[model samples]
Target: MQKKTIAVGNSSFIALIEDQHYYVDKTACFKPLLDSGNFIDLITRPRRFGKTLFMDSLRLFLAINPANPGSTAKQERLFNGLKVREDKNFCDKYMGQVPVLFLSLKGVEGSSFEAAYRALVQKIVDAAKMHAYLLDSPRLDEEDKKLLREYQSRDFMRDLANIDYASSFLKNMLFFLARHFDRQAMLFLDEYDVPLAKAASRGYYNAMCDFVRAFFDTLKPEAGLVLNDRPVLKKAVLTGCLRVSKESIFTGVNNFSINTICSDNVSLSACMGFTESDVLALLDYYGLSSRKQDVKHWYDGYRFGSNDIYSPWDVLNFCQCALSSKNPLEFKPDNYWIGTSSNDVIDEFLGFLTEEDAERMQTLIDGGSIELQINDELNHSDIRRHQSEDFWTLLLFTGYLTIAKHAGYKKYLLRIPNEEIRNTFRSRVQVRFSVENRSFAAHGLKLAEAATRGDVGGMAKVLEPLLKNYVSVRDTATKAPAENYYHGFLSALFACAGNRINDFQSNAESGYGFADIVFSSGYGTDRLGIVIEIKRTARPEELLDAVDNALKQIDEKNYAECLRRMRCRKYYAYGIAFCGKNCEVGGGTLREV
Candidate 1:
């Protein structure tokens, strides 16, 4: 099969189609949304789940080109071969029939309220420029034209940044478009809650809220509206990661409909992410059908409504990487989703971790689910409180956690979604433990020191307490070998030494085998090296035997040959074994290379 070009980061609908990039046909979602008859709709999904791309497709499908109002030839070509084009009646009635005001608040963020308010107004100016032709439309009065010109100017945008001036901005923009097109405008507000989330994180929530609440209130219909007495908007759809409560942002707005991860509407739920069939078809097209199970293990645990979905971003990225590899079958899957955005929210949430929460988190890391009251509608302020429910809710919406099942009213079982997200949790937990308890780092360095001095009992003393108190891994749900987890824990502990250790290597090839860890520290004559081998057992009684076996392997396999190669005059080799939290340590006498 021929490979279609995977546009890994292209979110524009027109660009994806015109550039001939591999496009997932989500155009089918357009019909239901248009036929719902609801004046306003809010759809929330996790970040990078293709929400932006979905909204762009909707905009391009419905928007009447300001430059050529009489023709949709360009859009017709764009939608060609897509699933929605199959519906002739739907296409004839709605496609390219409406004026669309597409505004994204995703980039409306700053360190302070003033700066963020400036960004918001700048976005308004950018949106208005798209309709600069409205200034020349004979249907608009001179006063409306003057306002449009002012909105498109940077000088006027500076003045409009204030809450009082910006409050009526959207209403007036819709009115101008309505007059130009002789029809009420459709509004697509993407990432609508981004400003508020940024504001909350930066300690300016109230000021931003005052502006957002007033700005969004324009969606409501008023009895005194002119222009044939039609409401300013024919329809409005807002896409965001979290659904801010109606009482907060959408105050007084009637006929509002929300589709979230927990929504009962299966169609709406499947709209944002790739369904199983979508993934299978994409993989088959890319000739990666053999790797379907590997692909699912990393990125396919997200549950949206009644459908199981995969992260479109991750799947496309994985496919792109696989196709680029010499042997696609041997290409290992990676955590592509975590690197796209800040995992600081997870870090912040983990900072408030208590003893009970840590245990619960470990259970989640072990592939087990925990019951929590899930609230899909949460504002940044609710997240700021660090309540358990709020944190988990944020996690669910942000794609770190997924719903395993519903337990009771408002209660649901949540687990780390897949291997990619589980790895994120594990790394974050390690950092959280290292940062929150400064003594943990001290103990970690001391453990290394003990291992370097061939003091087996000292190494065991430090390892046992840490393994018991701070380790986040156990018999994971995937049933991966326990040795890898123990190896990771020891590597993380040694990693905390930072600059003190000159070099640290994990699973580096040595004389005859791959050593679990080999590191060199100090300088000149004082330079020293340490070699470690980690093992895990199911029963405490087997810990000593595991430790002895590890020691034998380190010697027979010449794990310390790596230390000698690193030019360390003196080196120490040790073996550590773990059964749950308890551990045993063994080592040979310190030796010179």
Candidate 2:
């Protein structure tokens, strides 16, 4: 494959196109959103899923100045040959035709509302500089000009940074932009909840909430004789990972529309992430046709309004690494997206981990689905509260998990989305809670190393703690015990080893039928190919019987045939049984569950 540039972070769309980066054209989303009747929109999607990129694109597209020939021509050239260009009529009608007031509160981070509020002020300062040409506009009255200058003034910002003034300040600013440009303006708030989330982490939720709440109320300013009037913003769109409730952010704002992953909104469903076709176009261009299925398995399970989408950032990160890696083998689909800013909220969530939290996590990790009361309406403080509802909802919103199906009546089935996210969850559990002991990965590796050497006692050491702490009692959605839970527990351990083991699999074909688990050592795999059969019974008294039954089944089914097929120098078979938290193991040399 020839070399290709790829965007890794917050680079410009124009830069991505002009620099010849591998671009996925999601321009089809532009027109539908532009035409959507809702005047104010709140689009909630996980971070790094291209929310900022899409917002930036929207800002640039609508920031199109029809009267300014140079600016219009530049935007047209930037979008030339893109998916949007195919619809010339739509492009002609809407591209850069109005004023845009774009504000991103993403990077405003601090311990107190005061510090974080100042960071927000800096964004306004930057916006003022971008629109400084408005000062010379004949349309601006002396009053509007003074209002703009006052906002730009550092002293004014400092005075306003500490109260409700900071919240309603943007409303006045938008009014100024409207008057200055002689046009109603579209407003974009990128990472709108970031400051609130930061404040929640810092224990300033109330102060932050008071400020943010009043600020959002600006979108619904009353007008006319009754004074209960419409906001001046022609159209407003806000993007964030989680949806803070209308009761909080939009308090009195009417006719507000939210396009979240859980929504059936057609236009916005495919808006946030790159669709499968987009991914295919990218892979075909890069001559990675052979790895299509690999990418699909790892990055492509997210479903939004019947549209399957892949994380554009994850796809780009992997493709970039692939393009740069001299050896093809180095381009493994490890969780490259994890170490990015994806897990900061997870770390915040970690501080509140309890035993119940560990159990629920294990249940999800064990390939079991969790049913939680789905409340897409949430606030930043909700995540830090001691509530299971908050934990599951936050996980679903933040991309570690996704909705499997709506169970109806405010309940949703949630699971680890795909291999990429599954690996991420496993790694997180081991890394974060491995405190006071060997990190989770170390213990799993020690067990993997022992299993390779056929050390039953060492495997016991690894299996015991895992069952008690990380393994859940219930199995699948069906609530069966033996099969899914044990299978999930073993799969999770191997997954924690990461690339240490090759072909570490569950319910994979072998011998006469399928084996519960099997793998050969390579990265962390043992030279001996191993197959395991698992049995579950409710009676701890029958643990021995369960183990024996599992062993007999393993032999009768010839589950070890998969190992023989591998032609490994040696092979090991294991029959494991679990009854409650109790376990028994039986195999070629050692017996336990």
Candidate 3:
């Protein structure tokens, strides 16, 4: 089957139509938005979920004729056969009827706050360039002409001083647009939070936040300002990933109707990710209906509000791969989402996980859920300074994990959404852990051998030195920064033995509950199995008690039941306790002492 050309990163609604690219008609979104009457809406969604494309759709729908300012003939063909055509009233009311102030801050990336700000300023300048006709409009007065001509000034790029003083691009652009069109302007901002997220990761969050807020501050009425002096922004729409608490970015703006995955309103849920109908239609179109369940198990687990939506990007990429395969079953799912973007959230947060956090992650990775307090509103700074459930909130916001169950208000039982994210967790841990000293990684063999015979003391000695350097000492277990460091290190050790690590499960089901870490030597009468329970203690004095408790839990839980059922020759269960730089290992056969 020949695959239709996918608009992977193409954000142009017009281009998608003109080039006949494969697209899901999200123009239905234009109605609820029109009915809401809320203009300054910030629709937050994870990356590659059609936010940018939607922004483009809205721009084309509202934009005055770019080729002929007095007429909208050219833009009319762009929406041919789209969903918006069903609503004759909406089409007559909005299609290319208003002046548009469009700006996309998605490409703004830099090392420092100033550099990023410069790039953002450049984007603003380019948006003004898109409306160069505003300057030539006979309706514009001299004051507006001065403002529009300032945009054409080449020296503005080098003049950071002027940009710093008067840099509300949205405000100035809207002002000029309103005057030129002799009516209020509709503003469209795509990936509005991209700069904020990038700045947070780059250590310029506060500065970027201030700039962002300052820019938005112009959108509202200021003190000592009359109706005439107010911002020209009428119905403005912005799209990005994080909502970033009202106290953080949208501090003063209360008019915003934010639609996130957790929102009570399900109207925009289908608008974010591809809905079930969308997946079904695409599969049928591509002649891959037989593999629907397989595709669902892989790329279709994300929950937005109350709707289940597949990642449009992943689904398209899956089709791209499936088109090359002779059979749908032959094409396996991979981390298609992570492949196109940086895993900054995963990579950065892994370094801060506490013993408990890492343990929870292990459980989630092994197809389990962990309870967490989730705040739908979050900032990038919260991610860095946070030691609590906010980490899960950020991950959920970014689509790495989804709500497995909502326990209560601001509380959720989260788990990895599908095989793609699960593989990412495994791969990231492997990279972060296996890159340490070769000698330390080599110790995994010795550690594995000791576990085979349940040499508790020997295993403790091998891990003690490694923990001293790798363990992050949190006064409590709620936040373990070095949780992944040691867990990954230990896993890497077992992994060093070639295919032997294939039998390892960090939290595998066995007796009644689950085992912390288990290693089985395959199904053989002579083979041996190893079970280890890990516990973290805040004080060295508690190490012994912790080890004792772990061993008792292992016994009580019957963690070796699975291996025993497999008819293994014998299996060993060991208890390991960690306290800062000290550790005490226990449990083994009666003779191993």
The candidate scoring highest on TM-score is 1
Whole-model alpha-carbon lDDT for candidate 2: 0.72
lDDT of 1 by residue, 1-593 (tens): 55569998788998888777899899898988989989899999888888899999999999897888878897788988888999999988888889888998988987677778889888988888888888789988898888888788867777643456577778888888888888878889999999988888666899899888888877877621457777868889999989999888777888899998877786688898899999999998888999999989999998988999998989999999988999998899988876887765555555444666766777888899998898767888887676777877888888888989988888889988899888887776545644455455556667766766678888878887777676654343247777877787788777655444657999899989999999986555557888878887878999889888888898899887877767798887777888777888887477775
Cα lDDT tens digits, model 3, 189-233, are: 788888888877666798888878877765564411122554466
Which parts of model 1 have CA positions greater than 4 angstroms off? 160-163, 223-225, 430-593
Query: Per-residue lDDT for 492 in model 2?
Result: 65
Q: What is the number of backbone collisions in each predicted candidate, taken in the order shown?
A: 0, 16, 4
Cα lDDT listed for each candidate: 0.81, 0.72, 0.73
Flag regions of model 3 displaced more than 4 Å: 1-3, 66-70, 223-231, 326-329, 429-593
**Model 1 / residue 412 / CA error / Å:** 0.7
| Candidate 3 whole-model C-alpha lDDT, 0 to 1 | 0.73
In model 3, what is the error at residue 165, expressed in angstroms?
A: 5.6
Provide the lDDT at 111 for model 3.
64
Judged by whole-model lDDT over C-alpha atoms, candidate 1 comes out at: 0.81
